[model samples]
Target: MPFLQDPPRLTNAYLADPLLRELVARALPGALGEVEPELEHLGELAAGRLFAQQAVERLLEPRIEHWDAWGRRVDHIELTPLWREAATLAARHGLVATAYERRHGPASRVHQLALVHVLEPSLDVYACPLAMTDGAARALLDAGNAALVERALPRLTSREPARMWTSGQWMTERIGGSDVSLTETVARRDGDDWRLFGTKWFSSATTAEMALALARPEGAPAGSRGLALFYLETRNEDGTTNGVLVNRLKDKLGTRKLPTAELTLDGARAVPVAGLSGGVRAIAPMLTVTRTWNAVAAVAGMQRALALARDYARRRAAFGAPLAEKPLHADTLAGLEAEREGAFLLAFRAAALLGASEAGVASDAEQLALRAVTPLAKLTTGKQAVAIASEALECFGGAGYVEDTGLPRLLRDAQVLPIWEGTTNVLALDVLRALAGEGVGEALAAEVNAHLAAARDPALRPAIEAARAALARAEAWLAAAAGPAREAGARRLALTLGRTLELALLAAHAQWCLDHGRGPRALAAARRLARHGIDLVAEEPGAEELELLTGPSADGGAR
Candidate 1:
């Protein structure tokens, strides 16, 4: 059947759709670039590689180890580079896209979801001194000398990675944690040389030879606006220190791979980035990518937890049947599946949008969408991933709680997704403000309509109609947001509605594939989820909660 679910469903669809599979195969780049493997988090491909050359007789290495490593809370990032390098090569060689849609088909989205969770890095790469293991300083000219090596030289149509990681990270200070305005990092100008003073608190402050840092020059504007994006490099021909110091590691809850650190900058020399007082503007693009990645990581966590649970249910038996065979267990599985699909759609659709947008081509509209969606991804996915892992473990009873079962690792790893980048309330407020911007509702509506048209599923008609009504009711709720209480209530409704809109768009996209005769599996999955979504939306609390506004009984007004 045409079940257009997330990865597993997508995998079937991908195989059925020859064109998609071919497209992925043609898209992969062979040798010149780095690569990454998505299976490390899912079925456990990494630990397999480590044990490939086993001394045991007739026993091929276990594939399960790679999967277990994903459960490692803070160290997954450390294992990421190898896969990244390989995956990059495959994409470059026309084997796949960074999303790996070409190679894995629809399943690539699943792979990507896994990758982010496993390689999750807590700090913003650009701001984190621990952004990379190796350190360097780069000034303005260096800012323009980016290492988007594969991206700069493009070929024919395979989905572009649309990755926004600049070969840098420059926004942090000894005083800068959540507040950027109070940064004490100094960049002193000396006839093209801007010397830096101070350090970074939790900068993964690693990557490329040069970094773009936020610095305040002598007698600059008072606050964040006054700062400039300066470039710094590690070397000065002496091979010693360029005044940029790698202080120490950050002991944290999760995302400890790539090394979050306290860095030192003692007269670290740098150069003035172009556009005076453009530090904020210069850094915004980088921040957008980072925030988006953070969101992706959260979604990935959700998918991993869901996948783990799904696998457990299929295998773990209780009460004379597999746990998944039980009715309550089935219901739990269904909920997790629903959450996973919704999150996958959110993550990939955002990536697809960013890929389609021109480089550095950010609009207020786009920014608003990013702000509104990213936090939802973070909050919902992070919290849900934990729950999914825990519940999946419950299916296994005592084994699930044990370290050998690896369920605990999944929960522990997901702990940091929401905390990093920005906290929940911070993102929620941003969503509120962004959605409040003029015509956002209309814009969102247009987006939804376009997706619906693409889905084109006759079987989805009932649910679609229901969803339409739900959207209308939800809109009315938004419109009625007047007082503080009303507005607060409306915001909650809006958030749920927004999530619906996100799912609706993806459901529509999946439908478009089936309608165009792409994959039966995707079509089936889409039908199920789209129908479910419609039902959910139609069940608006407001419609039921409020008394019907009607005239008196027809028989007699007094009666």
Candidate 2:
């Protein structure tokens, strides 16, 4: 019997995937000529050294120490070598600093996010803290908190590991899940400083140096309007906890390497980043920044899973032929590729907009489109990651189910995509809200139509028509649906919008390939995605049917 050999290792992500290179070239052709070398280096590191480290450094979870041998209430968290490596790489490469520096103007965001796409999957969940840190920086800048901006921005964006700092987002609490209106955290002023007192549930990246939290002032009105964004450092200069008690680390299903914890504030001192009123509005910039990170991370995970699966297919054999040589296996891989390309197009488009918006170069239409697509991309790509990762795992057969192969971890880690930043349903509601704002839907339709118009390939025609049809249906649904019925079908509508956008982008990429005399990969991806059919035209139910869904069950139980 022939001894089954392991799959060929992917040493360099950029060199391995011509598709990623092509996409970056198409996205920023002029800039790509300059940034290509850096991207290539980053890609090599990701696919080679980082990939090897992840395999060898298995089961590296962060542990929290709440008490010392001497009974000192010292809160210490120990990180694995993988996380340490990720942190060092993040600082050395100016991953966070690049975006803030705006060296490439509007193209800076594109460059930064591209690097993130290559860096994140192998970062051992370092992206979580980095996302929050980026969000915090943008929030501080938008809030125009001069003191906090000067002090925090440097640390947040520093390229030196000793000077760099990660940030935690302490928005979620015991009372509030996604609904910030239910926030019970209280903030009372003591002289010039604000003292926050409450328990924060689900504190991801608990090892960060500081955090951005939402707290309601004592006399402020109720609901989300009363809440204010507060900034707090995790420690004092004396190396003591700043009235912050680390309860315990969460035993999560995935992202176990990440230090997620429950924290209680015994009058933790804080500074207000924005006005006491309209805290949600003040956080708009932060949301824009972080959602883009989530979308990029989702697509990155999908890419990594696909890469591993494709590598495995070449080595594994059945029925006297290699899996890669099997027509059915090829078809499955191509299907996954189509999904990945669609997600990539949608996500990069969002990242580009964010870069433009940050650079103050986005047009009015582009601004509206950015708002609409941020949530759409986040929600869509998040689900796609989990689905694609699961499929990729199956590509390995029995080996994929084995933990030692590092295949199951891809699926486990992908599970966090949908749950992080916001769930699919919550993001759907955000999309609806964006649509409610003037010009968002129109801008989205315009962008999609322009892309569809540019795509001249025969294979893109179906996707073009479907995208147009989906856009029409979305507008109609937005106009007709109201009250609870509108709320009930928000997810369906948001997904339809997201999927249509993806098809439009895929078609556009295919067109780019045609113009550049490239191969059939983009066209193939476009055709497959189009054939999948855009899920845009769900039949709206009548009042009774709507009630059946939203109302109580036969036993009078709530959903």
Candidate 3:
């Protein structure tokens, strides 16, 4: 045989993913036995067929058909076979349905998210629409909207392909992305029905059957408070456009398989899901749900990239031996592994909290911790995924740069994780807000301490102490910094908190592995992660440096 360029064969995702299995076993021990068979099946489908299709079927992309053959305005987006197949597989496997059904109580979310993690990388970005759908369901359920819930919930969680429906979350506009305070969309009363008139600049799931949007009614108060959550079906019963017009689809660097469109809602009929006042507060449930999805997808992408790189390392020899045998390459892979372990712990912790809270089973302290960790996990894991994906790409050297190799797509897709749900800065501020609530910071610290205490390893003591000291410094910074100063350092504080929590969680998992005879792999991961150091927060910049960083100088660039 010549040089033998073959890589390892892809195995079932769930079976191959020992880390996810361990996390699942730790988080939802009882439910794991029930969810295991389904996950194994989903894993097989994902790793074998879905992975192969995504690699060879490079031309798969969503195309928008804005007009019919007769030149009539008929906006329809065509999905590729892979997208359709993946969507069906997702439904059949109970990805969204499991969460809605809550078959396993709070543990159902862990199971559902784990399934999503397995299927995410090969889902052709179908997770985008599913996220919106899940959020919409949660919002409707929380709002006590019996009518809308009755109509949408069943289909949203439907197992049948013909019956299942995805939802679009049309929040972004020409005004801005995260700042809905600048929303120009207006809602009007017409007899018993409400009409929505607005332009949604960025609506993923253009082909969705319904959408949840924010619009202000006439004479409503200004800012986000005036905005109302509106639920509208995008099409009539006859399958005609229900006053929602798809303007155009986005052509982008990544997630091309997702039909993201600019939409116009002209007199679209809608019903208010929550109170007309404080609509921003009303949308919290949806945001929480979507943010969790965003974090899960982020971690899933990281796992996929690492899986490919690790496999390639064993087969792709460098000078004298396989890349896996090289000390430097081994170190790089281990570093990626450590980052991924922390990310996995953080993301799953958020999911577990979401499940507990949604089930109304969370304690007072747990609820506060949930509030802080949700944003922390979303922002931190998203950034981690992008960095890990970049490193994983480099593991393949030149082949990673080649588009046809299916390696570039990993980086392309990873780029969107941090930007979606919320950007880093936006989420950092959200962390600050969550911490501002009574008992949130203390609850978070308590949770971290509890996890840290689980690891009795003397070597882990230093890392544990460093994490506590970082927490103390964060609390001090938050206590001292005020107004603009606090805002300036929010990202640093949030990162420190997020990283500390992750390290604590990893330590706890390492202890669990040690006690359960699962060996020292997890302990090693925790140790490597700790080596990254916990000194994340820094003193505020000097006035001169702050001014230069914040805006143009007072001297108008003359000095």
Model 2 clash count equals: 0
Q: Write the per-residue lDDT of candidate 3 for residues 405-460, one digit (tens) a residue.
A: 77898999889988888899999999999889999989998989999989898767
lDDT score for candidate 2 against the true structure: 0.87
lDDT of 3 at 192: 89
Candidate 1 displacement at residue 45 in angstroms: 4.7
lDDT of 1 by residue, 388-428 (tens): 66675665566666654334555665666556655655555
Model 3 residue 458 lDDT?
A: 79
lDDT of 1 at 486: 51
User: Number of backbone collisions per candidate, in order?
Assistant: 61, 0, 0
Among these predictions, the greatest TM-score belongs to 3
Model 2 regions more than 4 Å off: 1-8, 541-559
- TM-scores for the candidates: 0.66, 0.96, 0.96
Model 3 residue 196 CA deviation (Å) reads 1.0
lDDT of 2 by residue, 225-250 (tens): 99998889989999889988999999
lDDT of 2 at 231: 89
lDDT of each: 0.49, 0.87, 0.87
Regions of model 1 farther than 4 Å from truth: 1-47, 50-176, 205-208, 235-238, 359-387, 436-439, 456-470, 473-494, 513-559
lDDT of 3 at 114: 96
Q: Let me know the TM-score candidate 3 reaches against the reference structure.
A: 0.96
